[model samples]
Target: MEFFEKLKALSYRARLTIVLHTVFTLAETIGGVFFNLYLWRLTSSLALIAQYQFFFWLAMMLGFILIGYAFKNKGMSQLFRIGFWLNFIFFCLIVWLGERSINWTVYLGLLSGLAAGFYWSAHEVMVLSGTSDKTREMFYGVLMSGESVARIAGPALSAGLIWLGAKWRGEALFGYYLLFAFVALLFLVTELAINRVKDVSFERFSLRGVFGLYQRKAWRWNLWRSFVDGLMISRWFVWGVLSYLILTSEVWLGTMMSLVGVLAIISNILIGQWFKPNLRARLNSWGAALLVIAGIAYPLLLNPLGLVFDQILGEIIGIPLFTFAWLAWFYLAVETDYDGKKRQFEYYAGHEIWQGIGRILSIGLFWLLASNLEQVNLARWWFGGLSLLFIVQWWLLKKVRTALVKAGYKEE
Candidate 1:
């Protein structure tokens, strides 16, 4: 009750952004869980999924660079709407592709990545402009909570729809098509809503200048943090593990994902209300440590029981803590002065590039390793590797706190 009231006290722009993100999250969750399943059903190759994601990250990196330039020259809303429409097209293309050929999955990944880069870049800018430093954490918490709620509903609904389609048309693909269509409609609505937001413009920045920020100690750490963050959150780790579980057991995909969502919702509420600014470092450290533990435990529990235990721990503890830390640090990075509004795009662009590089490395590595190993051995080795990677983030969080302190911020 108190938390909702606090969220309500935020500025109108912040509230609007929350609403927009909630819609976007709902649309994403509906088809996102099933996308890999669709590909897996069509082609039972992990390599194919890896290649698809590889290209997706590659395209996203390029899109971030290009779209950042566009945001500087044009208005933010234009790029955002373009992203929305592109995503709608991406889904439409998938519907058209429909098991006819698995080869097109690569192209779809590229298209989805491009759409993501534009949409997320614009969305972050909106979040930056909409909330002040005082209200940023509150806004982020509310946005996350809203996303958790959407996630809970979306996966469960998607599962039911898939079941219905299987019963009615005798093909689960039909349900995927329906879900994709709904996602398209949601994007259209989102596009229309963007028109209501105030328009803001920025002066153009040189690509050279943006890339050159890596020389500074703070910027370098920020970039590295983006990479580490990217590695932690990549699909290869989260979805890859989950997909393996579905393949091995009779676990209901929608129900399991929805259960995770339910836990995530509870964590979001606790974090939003109690995770104060001063406690950022402490909470982040704890989160990082827990993630490391989960990583270690996952490979040890390579069987069904281990997988279930890892999944439960990750949802209830690992995700919320790490997410809170990352969001807090990111908000600080964006809010830190880099000259003026003119250069904000460059900062974000640089951040995206670093993040993309990290994702590419993580996914590309997985593709390489998994390609060589027997499918039976892939999950175990992958989980081990992923657990070790969490240590990098733990180290990076400390560096971020140090950097923030040096920048005259009170506390991380």
Candidate 2:
């Protein structure tokens, strides 16, 4: 009822946009779990996992750049549809190849990455497409809540499918087969929702328009902020193999992930409904500080209970507030700036490159290090390194926040 009450206050477009995003994210979360599961069940090599992600993000970054250069505003909307079809095809290829799928890991990564790029490039633009500044913060809060819900539901549901299939067929991969078919269907549902939210036009794109954004004093630090934010990409996605190996139970893994969503639901709802424009600084600073503490604990404690604790702290004190603060500032900057909106495609594409560069460097380093370094040492090098990067990211965000305000935009 409370969630429904909040949605009632937003525009129909905004409501539909939230549904679109929620469903896409739900599909992504399900696919993510299975992709990791399939590869690990076959290869059991963490470095190969990193390599797969490396190509995926590399493809994703290049995809954004290519789409930026190639697509007009109208074509931009079509990227959403393209991503779904490609992703569906990727899943089909994986299922078709079966045990032989490991042979196509490189091509698989490239395909997955390009599909993700198309999906997210549209996401970048549509994030604020449906709402005005007046309702932007609330939109984010609700959006966060919905995404959290999806994250929890996706994994729990997947785990159940796996368990059911394992019981019935006595084969774990059978569960993945079922999950893949279901997620492909989800893509169709996501596309349907996207069509309901009518497209809005951004300023005409030109190479010169993109280069002009780099010259702006306010935007310079925001780009750097994105790079710093990217340093944690490895931290975010590579956990499926580790968790499954560590706990040896997808049930436990799914439960832990579901708990994260439960906590996020509480936090995001509060942030969305109760947060004020003035709390941005406090919220961000608090989130970063807790991230340092939680991140450090994450690497230091490697057991099942320890990982659960780490997730709890990250959701409660770290990710939710921090995400809200940064995103509010991020979307606000683009919403108000004259050049920022006119050159929005280039603007988001540039951020993607900077962040993608950071992700590639970190994930690529993981691929290299995981091959050479011991597991315990690699844990410290990976998670501990991300802790420090989060602080730097927050500091850069502070600079951008100040620069945006000084550039004549209000904090809201």
lDDT of 2 by residue, 208-234 (tens): 666677776657787888888777888
Provide the lDDT at 216 for model 1. 55
Query: Candidate 2 — which pairs collide?
Result: none
Task: Give stretches of model 1 more than 4 Å off.
Answer: 233-251, 302-304, 338-340
lDDT, candidate 2, equals 0.77
User: Could you tell me the lDDT of residue 131 within candidate 1?
Assistant: 78
Instruction: Please tell me which predicted candidate would have the highest lDDT against the true structure.
Output: 2
Candidate 1: which pairs clash? none
User: Model 1, 318-387: lDDT tens per residue?
Assistant: 7666667667676676567566366767777888888888888877877786688775367566656667
**Which segments of model 2 are wrong by more than 4 Å?**
1-6, 192-197
- State how far residue 70 of model 1 sits from its true place (Å): 2.2
